[model samples]
Target: MKATVDPGRCQGHARCWDISPEVFDLDEEGHGTVLVAEVPAEHEEAALRAAQNCPERAITVA
Candidate 1:
C-alpha cells in the first residue's frame, strides 16, 4: 500500500503520526507526512487506521 498526506488539508493534528509512526511522520509544524513511498505489508493496517483517524481527512492510503 501507498500513503500520502495532502498539505493543504492537513491541520497539524499529528494523529496519523501517533497511530502509525512507521508509515507516517510529522513535519516541523507537526502535520502528518508519509515517510515511505510504499507502505510495507506489516504497516498497511496501521496506515489505514491513521488515514481513518485523521481529523482533517488529509491522509490517503491505497
Candidate 2:
C-alpha cells in the first residue's frame, strides 16, 4: 500500500509518527509527512496502522 498525508487536515497530534516512525516523517510542527510516494511491501502494515491512527484522518492509504 501507498500512503499520503493531507497537510490541510493534519493537526500536530503526531499519532502517525508514534505508530510508524519508519513510514511517516514528522514536520517541525509535528504533523506527519509521507516518507515516500509509495510504501514498500515490508512497511505496508506499519503505514496502514499509521494511517488508521490518525485522528484527523489526514492519512490516506491505497
Candidate 3:
C-alpha cells in the first residue's frame, strides 16, 4: 500500500505520527508529511492505522 498526506488539509494534530512514526513525520511547522509513500507489506497495517487516525482526513492509502 502507498500512503499520501494532503498538506492543505492537515492541521498538525500529529495523530498520524503518534500511530506510526516510522511511516509519518512532521515538519518544523507541525504539518503531517509522508516519510514513506510506498509502505512495505509488513508495515501496511501500521501505515493504514496512521492514515485512519488522522483527524483532518488528510491521509490517504492506496
lDDT of 2 at 28: 89
Model 3, residue 42: distance off in Å is 1.7
TM-score top scorer: 1
Model 1 TM-score, 2 decimals = 0.96
lDDT (CA) per prediction = 0.91, 0.86, 0.88
TM-score attained by model 3: 0.91
Kindly report which residue stretches of model 1 are placed more than 4 angstroms away from their true locations once superposed. none
Which regions in candidate 2 have their CA more than 4 angstroms from the true location?
Answer: none
Q: How well is each residue in 1-62 modelled by candidate 2, as lDDT tens digits?
A: 78889999999798888888778898988878988877889888988888888888999999
The candidates, ranked best first by TM-score, are 1, 3, 2
Q: What TM-score, over all chains together, does every model reach?
A: 0.96, 0.89, 0.91
For candidate 1, lDDT tens digit of each residue in 1-62? 79999999999988898999998888888887888999999999999999999888899899
Cα displacement (Å) at residue 16, model 2: 0.9
Candidate 2 global CA lDDT score: 0.86
Model 3 lDDT vs. the true structure? 0.88
| Model 3 per-residue lDDT tens digits across residues 16-57 | 888888888999999989887588887789889988888889
**Please, what's the RMSD in Å of model 2?**
1.0
Question: Between prediction 1 and prediction 3, which has the larger lDDT?
Answer: 1
